[model samples]
Target: MLLILLGVLVLHLIILVLLLVSTAANAWTIGSTGSTDLWYKCLTTNGGYHCLPASNEDWIQAVQALMVLSVLFCFFSLIAFLYQLFRLVKGGRFFFTAVFQILASLFVMCGAIIYTVMSPDRDVSSSFGYAYVLAWVAFPLSLISGLIYIILRKRE
Candidate 1:
């Protein structure tokens, strides 16, 4: 039981780190000369990089908000899990933690999908970058961790 609990905690922490990186790193889309992220669009200049504020398009704003919300909810779920671990009854389940985590996963999925469909398509050389991939990867892991929380029972 102790080992199982430790594993779950570690998994939750990893997911949290992934979410933070995916949200903050400026590399959602990458091309030979530049990269774009939720916050900024950076292009290589003659000898340096020029970064401009991200476009004001509605979809980009939506993605930004969703990613922020996902991080918030995931962090909240981790706190809930720790609190419940000490306060919950022996047979109680981590329902609140599970629900928050599931919501976080959904937010991540929605954000990624919006970015995929709405990102500019003119650049044939551009490709999704590591931060974007990390967001997609975090989605399933978060969902699985939420399910585990739902099934976990407190034991002595």
Candidate 2:
């Protein structure tokens, strides 16, 4: 039981790292030109290519904020999980850990949903490549980890 809980905690941490990296890469790509800092000609003039400047900076900022929130939640959840493990050994219930886990999952879900609904079509189909997929993948793993935490119990 302990090992399983530990493994889930590790998975949650991995998902958090992946989410942070994906967000940073995406922000860089959206904020810069293909190879130069100059405004991407393709983005500013034409709309066929993926390396286009964002149509809405506000949307980008929102996504970035959500990503940051999600990362924070994941980090806190990790700490809570570790603390819960120690408490479990001492025969304490994991009320707080479970709360943190659920909250983290909710934040990830919100971030993922916002990206899915508000993201420009061109960015996902053309610009982001694997980065977009990675963000979506992190969502489920984080949610799974939270669910595991909710179900976890110390065995005598």
Candidate 3:
């Protein structure tokens, strides 16, 4: 039981870290000359690199907000889980944690999907980057973790 709880904790932590990196890393879109992310577009010029703010598109802003919310909710879920772990009696389920985690997964999914479909096509030479892939990877991990939390029960 202890091992199982520890594993779950580790899994939650991993999801949290992945979400943070996915949201913050400036590599959602990559090109031969530069890269772009939620916050900035960086281009390598002849002698130096230049950066500009991301587009003002509503969908892009929505994606950015969702991603930030996902990270916040996931972090809060972890804190709640730890708190409940100590306060709850044996056989109690981590429902609140599960709910928050599931919501986080949903937010990530929505953000990624929006970015994929609504992104500007001007950068025809660009391709999706590692951070974008990480967002997708984190989604499943977060969903699985939420499901595990729903099924898990406190035990002595």
Candidate 3 accuracy as lDDT: 0.94
TM-scores, all candidates, are: 0.98, 0.69, 0.96
Q: Top TM-score: which candidate number?
A: 1
Per residue, candidate 1 scores C-alpha lDDT tens digits across 105-133 of 99999999999999983387999999999
Deviation in angstroms for 14 in model 2?
1.6
What residue runs in model 2 are displaced by over 4 Å at the alpha carbon?
27-56, 88-93, 121-127
Q: Tell me the alpha-carbon RMSD of every candidate.
A: 0.8, 5.6, 1.1
Clashes of 1: 0
Scored against the true structure, residue 155 in model 3 reaches a CA lDDT of 92
Clashes of each: 0, 1, 0
Error of 2 at 91 (Å): 5.5
lDDT of 1 at 81: 100
- Between candidates 1 and 3, which one is better according to TM-score? 1
C-alpha positional error of residue 57 in candidate 1 after TM-score superposition, expressed in Å: 0.8
Using lDDT as the measure, which candidate wins? 1
**How many backbone collisions does model 2 have?**
1
